[model samples]
Target chain A: MYKKSRARYFFLMPGVVWILAFTFFPLIFSLYLSFTNANMRNFTQATWNLVGFQNYASIGSDLRVGETVVTSLYLTVGSTLLTLTLGTFLAWLFNHDLPGLRIFRSILTMPLFAAPIALGFMGLILFNETSGSINSIIRGLGGTGVRWMTDSWSARTAVLLLDTWQWSPFVFVIILAAMQSIPEELYEAARLDTGSGWAVFRSITFPLIAPALGTVALLRLVETFKILDIPFSMLGGGPGSATQTYSYYVYITGLRNFNMGYASALAYILVIIAIIISTVYFWRVRARFE
Target chain B: MATLKKEAVMQPVRAVQIGRSPLARILLWVAVLMAVIWVLYPFVWAVITSFKTQREALEPTIVPFLQFQPSAENWSAELGLGARETTLALGNSIAISIGATVLATVLGTLTGYALARFRYGIGNRNIVSWVLSQRFLPPVATLIPFFLVLQRLQMIDTVPGLILVNTTFTLPFAILIMRDFFADFPDEIEEAALVDGANPLQIFLRVALPLATPAITAAAIICFAFAWNEYLFASVIAPKDAKPYTFLVASTSTVRGVHFGYLATRMLIAITLPVVLSLFVQRYIVRGLSLGAVKG
Candidate 1:
């Protein structure tokens, strides 16, 4: 029995060891670091005390921290919903083999290949108020420039749009795969029986693809929680901290402010929030997937 | 049975789609055109801007090459015969991506094979989910410890350091995709090999691995792309020589002065590799991205 198990152990060893050293170790160590003064200032000293609960306590008192959570939630929820709606719509629209299916799908995936930071840069330049091409066209038509970066609503909109636009393709690809897998007979039968498009889609397509939809939503939600590059690069999470995402907050806390302990705590908070949301979301669909 | 039915039904559907009902096909094509426009417009502008002079980048042209003069100045400036930073960053990016890909694929394939073929105790199912959840841990959670740890080891600003971090993030997806791949592998073939006196490892290495080429290619490309496009950890960990193009792209745009043309040049350079690979393996990505969760 031991010999029989040996091969499996051998195969699993590297990944398990790597995960332990990198993921689990960092996770536990970060928890420890969150309780102590582990910033750059204290690094050379080679010593620091346990300032227990101080980091966690500070998270509540910092108004920006609270606002940043709200900002993250808003983006996470907003982007997930928008990406889902638009992506599902696009997926269904492109479900049929039309002209240039190959070309359109390929082009749609182009942004997904580009770095998020590059996309952020693209967002930065394209959404620029004055020199922006969007405004350039508007101005050419003799209209005033819209404050895309300066105004809060428009700033958030720009961030949301970028987030949604870049990610909607992900949703489309997933849902389209799901939709493709649904047997055509079911669709054909539904079509023959039901005259309305809504009836066929609702009864046959939507129900069949619900689990895939759930998976897409869950994945998108978790990913959107960690959104940093686009909003940070596009707006620096500002126009008065309007778009300061949760991960960006933790980034500033650790990297910028040198608040290692607090940032570690903030990271835990982010993880905990993600865990809860994903767990709740997964509970509903877990059985269905299996 | 199903394929035959599908082909039969699709025959008429195709006829209706293109020949009989021109309006619906045109409408579908129009919707597709709008989406394609949305995806490509920014990239198109970036390309046009890359060719424009610094002056032309600021100026809006209704028609590229007509309203403004097109020059290779930006591309030349950043990507010319002797450009060092861009070249170095590209080299570092390639090293890190390839390094991470090799590590992730080799280790992940084994682990994925084991998970797919064997069953542990009660925790059998939780393992995949547990590993996948690793990605959800905000990079900041690991960044601080990674920073401190690497600083102690004096491995900071090194390509190896960047590769290790990239490997960590890419491994889960690698494992999951490979697990999905191996799960989808023909059990009958492996069983037949087992009956022919091949041990599991031999069967895996000799039989399963050969059959998993599509998945392996997909896994390799996905891993490579993830590492190639990684920015946050790359920027924080690699301060100087080892920083990848993604980090340079961000820093050059935000911290340093904007040579808008140079920026566009970097953008085009940065996207070329992943874009090319993705286009080449476009089918694999959809499967890889969904972990083959979607049936098709």
Candidate 2:
């Protein structure tokens, strides 16, 4: 029995080592590095100056840091709500006994599989200020074309729109599955009661799929907060940092600016936010399970 | 009073039973058409644009049609099939993605099986949460660390390095999905195999794994798509040699001059592998989503 247990531990050792070396170790090291002024130029023979809480304190005073956080939050929250609501509606629509429903579902899901960077470039072409497909459509409709990536609010909206266009199908697929799992007997019971469609959904469907919906929302929130490639490729966080997400900020700080310590500090802040959000989500899931 | 109430409800019931009114039928068809168009227009536009000539694509035409003369010049240029550098990058992407998918699936299956069958205290839950938390950590947060590690290991700018990183990103989700799948599986089959003098390994390989083929396929496809489509890490780690087709497509920006034709061609090529893979595994994909969502 002891030998067998030892063999089982050996079977587990590789995965455990990989996770510890790559995931957890980096996480802890990053947290430590965040306190020091460790730039890439000094990387070879690095001297750590421990500035207690200075990096955290600097986050508030630094305008760009504040803006990055605000932008990331805005994108995360806005995209999650829009995608969930629209995706749920579209899923419900697709779930209806309509002709060519499979084709519609497949087409809607195409963007989900397309690379984010590709989608960003496509968005650029589609939403260009001039000589673009979308602008041309608007012009044909006798309306002036809006500067999508130039204006601050418009740029943010563009990011949100691109994210929604790409990821809503993911939410749709998940939610559609949830909706489909709903027992037919429950619906029949509601129908026998002569209940309205809204009443039936409220009484039967919503309560059952709430956990699935919550999980999807949580996943989207986490993923959206970490988004980098699309915005980086699309507007380069653009017309003066209008769409610089926290992840983008980290990239620019660490890579472009070579401020590793500051970037690490910013990253730690993101980690905290991620942890809080994930903890709440898991807690809610557990609560639901219990 | 009861008779009056019954009659009041009967009128609406009678109206509904009549059904298939011309107005309702027309409205339904119209709604369905709009929904279909909304879903398909982007892809149709992409395909149409890919075939258009450079000048034709630039023209502000509201009614762009796919009837124009088609050319494969852009495809040849973007893919660089005749050139060594571009072809090598493409090959690297395909190899690394496949390698990572296989690695992640195998490791995830083992870990998932352990968690599903074992009765470890708090450890299983911890592992589950740890996997979930991996998804939450911003990919960028780990970029520097990964770069540093890869550099130290002399694995930078290599296929194996990229595979390792991609596996880390993909393994968590695979484990989560597979664990759920294995949990839902009947234990009696495995027990019977055990009773036949099969060890745990044999029970897994001979009994449990066969039953989990559909879920495993789904996991593989998802992992492959992720490894294939990942951009930031590929960009940072393998800027030159190991950059995938995604990076290739992004690199085709119209900064100096708009190469709409070439851009469209590259985008189409980049999306081809994933589209084909997804279509092949569409059934398994649906089963996976349904299993994960509904069961949870």
Candidate 3:
């Protein structure tokens, strides 16, 4: 038993070391970088002065920060609501035993596994303003084609639509799992008592699955707030930065403009927001286990 | 009044009958068909676009034979021997994803087993919780530090550099999943091995590890898919020679204009691996996505 207990550290040490070296160290370094004027030009020189919250101070005046935050909120809330609604509806439909239902369910969840950025690139072709299939469909119906990428609101909508398309399946999968976990007897009893499908669902199925749905919703909230790949790939933060997300703006500042210090500051702000959201998520997750 | 109330309560059960009436069934089927189309239309569009010429690709054509003639020009351009960059990027993706998956699986399995089976003096719940929180860290937050660190090590734009980064990002998923699996695993097997004079390490290697193959594979495949689909780190740290297929797919628009046909081909390449692999791990996917908090 002594030998067994000691082996536990043997198992744990390597992962702990790797995390400290890779995850923890980089996070600490980023925190430090946020306080210094660490520009790409100075990086090679290996010299940077400690700026001490100047980077944070500049954030108040930086219009880009405010704009990206607003854009991110829109993308996050819009996509999350759309995905949840579609996913819940699909899950409810899938809960039924129809012929070839497995095949249809598999087909519907395909987008969940596809790379988001790749899908975003495909979104470009699909939502293309001219000679695009979507526009063609609109024109076929005798309505003028919408400018999907050129217009700011339209570009934001394009991003939201693509995000929803990719993630709704994920919500579907999670919600479906939750729905299936409900005992068959519970629904059977509810049906016998109420003699109404909607009543049975409201009294039994919904209450049981609500927690799982909440968890999935919170998960999507955190994920959507970190939306970068789609906007980056699809529009390049385009239509004059209208589609720029918080992460997109941070990437631009840190990597593109080579303003590492300010970028780190922006990143820290995101971290704070993420931490707040994740705390709620962790609380919910813990509530279930406890 | 009481009899009328009783009738009123019973009326909705008949009037609002769900999924039973012929019209309702037809409507349900139509909704299901539309849902499938909504999910699949993008991939269909991309496939069709890949077989198009630049001019044809720019034009909206749903049908290949009727609306336009399908061509293989884009495929040749992307996959031909002359297309060294595209092929090389694809190779990088495979190499880096596999490398990270192998490393993460080993580390995560060991750590997860230890947490699940042993009482480490520190609170195991806290440790597991901390590990779960790592998944929430924004990639952009770590981008600069890793870039600078890798640049100092002179490892920028290298496959190994990317393998290291991808492993870090995906390690949390692996650990949380394996921990959940190991927690649910029966200890009688290990207990029997212990009676036979095998240490925990020996049991983990000879008994537990062998028995846990399915769980391990699920964790590994999930890790591989994440690393495969990764873009930000690949583009930032490994922009030159080590750029993955994801980077290539996203950057398809180049000088002159986007050859829509080529873009479509690359998108197809980037998505095919995960979509195919997803079929194998369908049962475990929700467990993976929810960090094993919700079992599928």
Which candidate number has the best TM-score? Answer: 3
CA-only RMSD, every prediction: 3.5, 7.3, 7.1
- For candidate 1, write residues B1-296 as lDDT tens digits: 33453355334222111324688668877887888888888888888878877677787664766798788888777878888988999999999999999999998898888778776663545666566667657787889889888888888899999989999999987887788767655577778887898877888889888877767788899899889999999878896989899888887756556656677778778777887788766666665565444543
Interface RMSD of each: 3.2, 5.0, 4.0
Residue-level lDDT tens digits of model 2 in B114-144: 7677645456666566655677788777887
Write down the worst ten-residue block by lDDT for model 2 chain A. A1-10
Per-candidate fnat, comma-separated: 0.52, 0.34, 0.61
Tell me how candidate 2 scores on lDDT. 0.72
Find the candidate with the highest lDDT and give its number. Answer: 3
Pairs that collide, model 3: none
Per-residue lDDT of candidate 1, residues A1-290 (tens digit): 32245677777778989999998998888889889876776544223569999988888888788788778888889999999999998888877866556667777777777788887777777877877798887888999888888887788778888888888998888888778777777867866786776787789889988988988887888888889988876677888888888899889888877778888988998778767865665454333222
- Candidate 3 per-residue C-alpha lDDT over B15-126 given as tens digits, one digit per residue, 9 for 90 to 100: 1124557987888788888998888888899999999999998788778899999999989988988999888998999999999999999999988887788876656776
Local distance difference test values of all predictions, in order: 0.78, 0.72, 0.84
Q: Please state what fraction of the native interface contacts candidate 2 reproduces.
A: 0.34
Those runs of model 3 whose alpha carbons end farther than 4 Å from true positions after fitting are: A1-4, A42-46, A287-290, B1-19
lDDT of 3 by residue, A100-163 (tens): 6557767877888788889888888899999678889999999999999899999999999999
DockQ for all candidate structures vs. native: 0.52, 0.38, 0.48
